[model samples]
Target: MFDLNNFNQESASLIQELQKHVGEITAIRRFFHQHPELSRQEFKTADKIAALLESWNIKVTRNIGGTGLVGVITKGLSSKMIGIRADMDALPIDEATHKDYASVNQGVMHACGHDGHMAMLLLAAKYLSLEATFDGSIVLIFQPDEEDDAGARRMIEDGLFDKFPVDCVFGMHNYPNAPIGQVMISHGPQMAGTIGLEITVTGLGCHAAHAYNGIDSILVAAHIVVGLQTIVARNLPAQDAGVITIASIHAGKANNVIPQSVEMIGTIRYFDPKTAAIMEEKVKSVAQGIAAAFGASADVRLKHGYIATVNHTEQADFCIKTAQKLLKPEAICLTKKPSMGAEDFAFMLAAKPGCYLFIGNGPGDGGCTLHNPAFDFNDANILVGGAFWTQLTLDYLA
Candidate 1:
């Protein structure tokens, strides 16, 4: 075990050093916020990150998974390696905050705090490069397409682990609900697995005046949606949690003519793998049954998404203790509830023993929830986050 007192003393000095670059860090974050890019299409974003990493004398590898997902490696003394990841994707939301740094792209915004994640990781890379503080190699991953595509899995598929396998991997996301300067770590499941589903109900089109002449696909879709709720409310165990939400429904264009097909899109979230499988089975069964009852046929397509992020118990404890020593004891939260939001970092955890933690991005007073048009990454948490990352690297690699 590492000495907590010594770690705190070193971390405090490191954080103070990090504070000196707060202006540059904040500027980089805002530049990313203003010129946001979407999913697999982050060309300029990747270039900017690569340039910065190269300037720090860190080895940069580009086009690993796709146009995005830049990997930077800092060689150290120890043979053991650890990975730190930060996402670099923006959403398709138009800027609504009305700030001067609001996104210049009409419908692209970094509302999910990826900009801040990238900035903090970059700061950590610079510090580690200059100080050579950690003993083992550290891999800084700036992944893309986190909002839409599973960039983590893509990178893994493209030989991320085979090329640079690490003993442990760590990831972080900004949490708006938590107070600023705080860190939350949880054991076991930290985020629910997500499945994107599209259900198409086909029926014979007819005039609205003739009610009995044709099957109404809209009615079938409605029944299917309501019935799918039973999968969570009744089928799953009371202790387990799951959600089935239908976010979109497309059917008739005109009031007079019934449409031939009705398309519905939704997402399913569950923490347990068994529960997730059961929910998928139930959804398919409900869609088929409801379609048959309405004299229509249904086609349900399920797109496998990110797996649930389950933090290793020992790793979570280690992170909590390290965080407590670096920051105030009150600033460390250990019992945070798992969120339904999905993360691509789940892929990294699936391959290695690791943990994904939440760092406070401050309250949503004027700021908005993640994925919202008005959301912006908070600069106040830069030192706090940089300190945490630096301390975690030293503790794990020592």
Candidate 2:
């Protein structure tokens, strides 16, 4: 545990030292906000990041996993190393904030605070390069395509850990609607695993006036949608958590005719693998059974996505202690209830022992929540996030 009394003076000094780099970091964040790129297409984003890191006299490695890069900084004689990660992709949402630095690229925006993440990590890298007294190396990862695809998985498949391995890795994301200056850390599962579901119901097409002549696929599809709900309501235990949402449904084009097939698409979220497996089995069984009862046939497809993000206990405790040194005692929260949302960083945790953290992004009023067009990264978090990153590196590498 961090000694608050012994580290109070050091924390203050670190905050002051971090402040000197805030201006440039904030400007760089805004620049990224203006010139946003979609996943797997972050060519310009990669170029700019590489240029800035090179200018700071850090060794840069490029094209690890399509547009992903790593920056290295070494100090002292120890061989121990730590890895810190930041995502580098923007959503396909148009700019709605109307800020001066709003996205110049149409149909693209930094609605999920990836811009702020990059800036904070960049500041940490720069500060560590200049003032690091710790022994060993620091690996700064700038990953791309976190929105649609798992960039962390891609990086690992492309030999990321093999090329520049570390003892452990760490990642952080901004949490909107939380009080500013507060942080949340979970010891176990912090995010849910996601599964994509696509169901197709096939039946004989017939005129609406004489619907009795043939089976209606649309009607069967509706029943399947309703039946899927029971998987969570009746199948799972009372204490377990899971979600089944039907987001999109497509069937008939005209009111007078029944379509031959209906397509339904949605997502599934759960913290436990057993729960996920049960949901998957139930989804298929329910759809097939309902279709058979309606004289229709069904086909279900499940695309597995990122797994649940489970933080290692020791690393999570270390992170909490490090955060205690930087934040007030009341500002640190150790939560057991995890978010229903999914993160690709879960893949990284699966690869190595690590911890994922959340920093408050202030209020989410006026459509500022994540994935919303009006969302923007709060500039106020630069100092706190950067200082935390810097201090965590120093302590972990010491």
Index of the highest-TM-score prediction: 2
The superposed Cα distance between candidate 1 and the true structure at residue 111, in angstroms, equals: 1.0
Expressed as tens digits, the lDDT of each residue in 198-316 for candidate 2 is 99999999999999998999999989999999999999998888998889999888989998999999999998999999999999999999999999999999999989999999999
Candidate 2 Cα misplacement greater than 4 A, ranges: 1-8
The runs of at least 3 residues in candidate 1 whose Cα sits more than 4 Å from the true structure, single-residue gaps closed, are: 1-10, 69-76
CA lDDT of each prediction against the hidden true structure: 0.84, 0.90
Error of 1 at 323 (Å): 0.4
Question: How does residue 267 of candidate 2 score in lDDT?
Answer: 97
